[model samples]
Target: MSYMDFPSFSLVGSFYTDPSTMDNDPSHYDESCTNPSPWQDPGGSHFFSFQDILASKPNRAFTPPVVTCAFDQNGNPSLTDPLIGAPVNSTDTPGATNGQTPPFSPAKMVDLDVYQQGVSNIYGFVLKLTVGGTVLTGAMDPCTLNSIRFDRVLPTRGWAGWDSYGWGSFGGDSNACGVYQSVVRIPADTWPAASGSPILDQLRAATTQDTSGNLLLSIRMTLDGYQNVPWHASDFRIGRVLATVGPQLATDPSHCLAGRWLAGRSAGPGDAWDQPSLYGAPFEVKNNTVAIDLSNALMTSAPGQGPLNLGNLSVYIGDGSTGVVGTPFQTNDILYSLSGGIVRLPLTAEQAAAAASAPFFLASSLPGINGLSTFNKQPVLWQESATGFWIACDDRNFQLASDQPNPGSQPGFFYVTQWGQPVTDASQIEHHVFPCFPNNSAATVPWSGGYKGNSLSSDGCLEAVLCPGTHSGQFCLELSAIWDPGSRTPELESQLYFICLWQKGTPPPPPNLESGCPPQEQMMSAVVWSSYQINTKPDWAEIQRLMKVYVKLFPSMHARMDLSDQQTFQIFSTNPPWFVSYANMPGPATYTLPSGGVIASGTIPYYMTRTIDDPRLMPIMRDLSPNRLLTVLYYCYNLQQETQPTPPPPGEGAPHPTATPTRKGANA
Candidate 1:
């Protein structure tokens, strides 16, 4: 026999009073089956009343609940009980030798060692009592079993501590009747009911599925016999019920298979991809073996089904990478074309379960092209389209320095493949990538990107600034491909351009350009990195309005800048040295302002400007209000040219970039 280590499954055990069938005895509080604290109790009776265990009250004779099991004349446990914990018609015989049943364990909390290697399904546990009639059996629904969370076992206190207040004795009553239960919380509610002599008084089970859909099973047991049982009165009165619930592994091959499966169509050739083309039905993984039926679409006998066209099928093994292209299977990746559409992977149940959650990134070679050809080499970068699918383009032959749009460039085929599916010609080679932005648009203007000429990068790139005429919460895509003015070869490239979204009342961008243009890029970058939107507005009046919104969102960036009549007028003076100059103040410089000054600065680096070359800043500040003038300073301050550190002599340590003494703003 070999041992395999499976993921640990939790088995929660608890006890609760059944108000309908059992009496509501306030004294019968939740208690543990195994209490360490020494307490006086009758011999062979660990069921000490709550008053004796907790309050040191006089000990009372009490019988703990247990499942009734039959015994033979030889004093050996017997499985003669017709309604054992196993399912109906189950041929499972744990004690086949000499008709002796497995000995019952007295503890309420028991560890169940479930073997998933050869097992298909697990029926309910088999619980037997040390002293009782032939049988006591019943099955409770998963919801009802999981709800009984009393007498829960704690690491420090085994079934001792109660997390809930209601589980304790209520209404000034003190009866010590311990409630013991263990159940699995799973999705199913169809638990088999009891069908035998001496119906079980209490039986609960709960189970939950792991990330891989494996069952974390648990069981609960409660026995009731002998009269005056402080907790409640049961309708069935039997002899002394001395019993305990123990673990019994019941395996059934007729039940549903264990573990999960992820299935999808194999990648098809780009030129002949078809959505209705049947490849295989939903597959199942049993014992780490998967069998996909190919007769459905392959066999001509099946109605309306075409002959099975065997294509390359592969299973995705994401080797710690993300995104489509980066994670796509290379020549080294595992490729599978199961024999007769049936293949078994060498993975344990736990490993197989984890694989089901990830989307399959199937890669297929173009028709007529060698599967391992150089041009068939996977593209270096794959930008996931807005449609949540991937579109592959081959630009190996095209030559260009800057990545930009070249509309009408080449009539190459681009593949649109879904997650975990193979690319076929029917779904591959498409002119459009995404539907018109907002999805409800009348015309479908697919936006494309990641090419040369109208690249997403590069200053003044046409695709970078594309936007719709109107703005709303939904996204819109525009064809940002600028037609070749000189008709320099009809190969113009086009890409989907996501319209730049901006906050309401944002200042208009530079004239003769896209509305939001590059400002929205800076705004979005700042918001994503530091949650601060640096002033990018060019108009002084509009800047004031944008500042109001920014100040409301981030009050900490708010700062007051009061300027005097002389300071206010001379602040923008670059020729004559004013009271504040970049030459004198290398760092933040402060200037005293007269009362009632209208300069309000917030979070903007307080740098005095000596020269203003930026087109956004006006040479003269006399025509502008103090607030508008400050706004110009705020915008220019952030626009300072990013300086790179100069290298030292070869083999010497690199020197840091020297700080420029003149605080001059760069041209936008």
Candidate 2:
């Protein structure tokens, strides 16, 4: 939607009008209202004093279009005595009950009466309340040198119809009071800049006026009460304004901040975030903040750079002509170049309107977070604005585990979460998960190894749900990738339901959370992280032998293996693949290292977080997932360990308690 087209009376300011016609371009402008009106409007118009009009809290009986007071036949307004409950309009005025009258007693106090709440692309918008008129021609008392300075209104930014009180601009008589009226002429463009520039070179403001001659901006703030004009208010202030660089303030005065709130978006799949699809996916849009992986375009260790860190990359959006180089409007005039690649420069629609070129750039440091080494940083993907998400500055990490020591090793679930790994959303497993566990050398050719086999359907859960499966054993994958830079080794882990597999109707034995894998309680269980061999490739012959033997061992188990999923890029092609440390065996990659082979690229990195530990959640396992982990272990990977792993370190559960099959390639 063209968000600018949105209509709202949310802002207030002053504009210009032709004094001769008494018409204003921007209608409904009202202002400061400190005193009561004493002089008649002379035009015989309905009258309401400024202070009486705003006496109520707002949204009360005083519907604040505020009655205009009549000017005396001489144009001079008098502030003699305070007028109370003077017939505002013939039919309205709320009265206080219980004999408890309020100060200067307003008819009523409105509760959130006119301030509506809703999302708007437009932020930091300014408006006018009333347009003052200029002294075109008027009768006057003879002017002395002291009378030279008159109370005549003058034009602002040029427009006799809508003007400001000029300095030494008014002339003619001192008592000079004549018919006060002006022609209405709204600006062709509502924004200060008809072009809608993202950066404001200057403060755009307006002045509100009350019949008592008090001029205010008419800004409505919950706290600090209704401040008089000339004082810096939160939303519209001339002095130190109050505002956050983040999204629009939900409450009245949270963000009167100077920095603009920018948008974010994913550059593409080439910039895969290091975490697995199950969790820690670099892409997120929440609380008006956007986070997307930008590794492809800015990774220091990317193709040619060796061991170099970008040191908080900088990403940009907008024309870049007027904004200070490397500074986010969100920042209180702080320079971005000062922030190591951590802080993000948010781009807003206003900036877009005045953009000179495509506004897209990367940052080395994430915005807000500071003072940290970037070596172990999770492929830094701060706010990618297109989504309008908000990530607190203090919430970002300062340090992480170093490069993977053994890129092929599986670092159990316990170790993974211990180091503060990010978790992925479950529903996107197939689209965002699975591809991380591709077939290592066993597939004979890396080109076809990444999920291109004939045994199972060639899709993840996104397609798995579409593929026909046994009604009783249907399951979806839920797995995680744990990378411990201490070992420079990363392992893919899966859950174990083979231990709990039984006929659909019969309930399994009580879960043993103390030892072995946690109990699988639901029909649709998550894909527990598991691997065939921690650091080596499984032979196809050995895989076939294991699969055949398992099927023969449990003839009615109806186990199925899916091999095509091991193929990298089957679901999505991205740069800096999920495995940033390891090289692809014989697949597409930006760099091919003679020592490590291929660096996996062009994919997502993050797996879903398992909910086995939450006491309140006991999903019926049989209904949610397919019987696929075993088939995966037999045909695609080798089980990590024979005995159930015990302790804070996640060890593997036995393949089966009763059987030990023979395979020459098997270590056990």
Candidate 3:
């Protein structure tokens, strides 16, 4: 049997044989019940004793060796030592020839048993081992065999050291020397090596079309460890640890699949994830029907209908009521529908009650349909019927009816309704009526003395007057008359002529003396007053009267008259007349009449001529008194007497009775 070390005594009693009930115990079992006794079977298929089993298993027990490790000056383990004995070098020998050192030299021993025993006694036994490329050394208690490390490097890359181990000189003693051992185990796998490669590969292939194929092969190995692991149960929390790491590892691939998953699900026969149908289809109840998919039916049909068949239903998914139909009944309407199927329109209670109570069709006809009555007994027909409906007379109808008038007879008055008579063509209706004149026919005369009845002579003096021989007269008449009978009117004669008449001779004068008259009396005749009629035919005086009338008729008329010397008797009517007197005087005539009816004749003496100069005369000779007329005649007589020359008598050489030179006093 192998020796076993019992560290904790709680497991010790199983090794010894039991004293009681020995006959039935395995140690006391019959030889027949045991194969090769209780410890052995034909092929060792029997239960092994605890000690034998311990001996057969690989040595899991750690026994510290008596190690006397020595340090060199650099604090490394030394090969040679004086007090502790040298390590035995297997290559060295004990006996040698020619003074060569022995293989097992006493001073250079590779295995120093004596020093090792001394080391065990001095401190404690210690064990040294190498694991995962790191060296660990531990001291053990002599009784407990438990480890107390002085210097060790763990497989996880942690270190421990002691103050007495020379690790102080290496600057590790302060950190390593503690009651709790400072042990660092180098990890078998690093985070970067385990996770970085897979993560990076997934990220790189995330854009590839065959990411699923690539990712499946790549990630299968990392996840396989948890294939049979139960949730929330493991030593060292391996499953939990893997679970935590799994999501981190899957972040890239999971993110890549997210968009594709959403797109694929959205492209199926259902509403997109972001939208929903608001109305659903009607339900059909039938026997033998199982459950129905309302979500799909809700998507495909109108609201208020439900329980449709799953095959006929569509997926309803999205934000709530996005595709809702039926005019979205208001909250009030919805409440009303829930209560009952009655819809209340927006009518007020009063209006509804009034409408319910009133008789229908009583006021149905339009307003103002009745015929309107005027103040008189006439009906105004303010409303009229068009087809079957009556229309009130609006302002347009009233205005039209007001404008209508009755036909009436035309009055005898000129009415200008259209264009006026054309003033431009008025000359066609013009008439040349004979314009009447006073004292003359309306006959046109030629330039000569005959009447052409159409033309008037240019020389004829025509006066257009308004005197009509009656009150209102004709206008613009021409008259032809001789101006002077003595010669042709001076205006008509261009030449000047002289005329000579016979003068009385003194011969045989006067029939040889008159009765009792003196010889001189017979010769010089007394002045006799003879009335010579100035035959002014065609009566220029009358013409003058007519001209005066003309001037009165037309205030703008003015004329100038000229008379010849031979026609001295021509009367002129002017406010003031210019007169000439023949006296051998250089000035105008001045005469004073004598009182009483006396006639005196004499040549105007030079002394009396001054008295007669510049005499004032009345404009109308008839207006003068007889005394004044006598005075004028007396002046003429006096002027004749004064200028008389002695003439020879009739037979005695005196002037003849009628030959006194006509007693011309002064030509005025």
How does each model score on lDDT? 0.23, 0.20, 0.17
Q: Write candidate 1's Cα lDDT for 1-668 as tens digits.
A: 00001111111111211111011111111122122221111111111111112122344332233222322222233344432332211111111223445232111111010000000111222232221332222221111111111111111211222322213323111111111233222222222333232222112122233354333333322122122223322311111211122222123100111122232232223312221122222233335533332212121112111232223434433331432222223221011111212232344454455444443223344343222212234311111112223322111011111112322221121122333232333312212221112221111111121112222222232232222212111121232323322211111111112122222233433332222232111111100000112243454344444333222221222222222122332232212222112223222222222221111122232223212211112211111223333445544332321222222334646322233222111101
lDDT of 1: 0.23
**C-alpha lDDT (0 to 100) for residue 345 of candidate 2:** 34
lDDT of 3 at 180: 9
- Candidate 2 positional error at 569, Å: 45
TM per candidate:
0.18, 0.18, 0.09
Model 3 C-alpha lDDT per residue in residues 70-132, reported as the tens digit of each score? 222222223333212212111111123345342221111010010011011111112222222
What's the lDDT of the predicted structure labeled candidate 2?
A: 0.20
Q: After superposition, how far is residue 24 of candidate 3 from its true place, in Å?
A: 99
Deviating ranges (above 4 Å) for candidate 2: 1-315, 318-359, 363-611, 614-668
Candidate maximizing TM-score: 1
lDDT of 2 by residue, 321-420 (tens): 4342344222211211111111323344444443322323333444322212122332323322232221111000001111123212111110001001
Quick one: best lDDT, which candidate? 1
Which of the two candidates, 1 or 3, achieves a greater TM-score against the reference?
Answer: 1
In model 1, the worst 10-residue window by lDDT is: 111-120
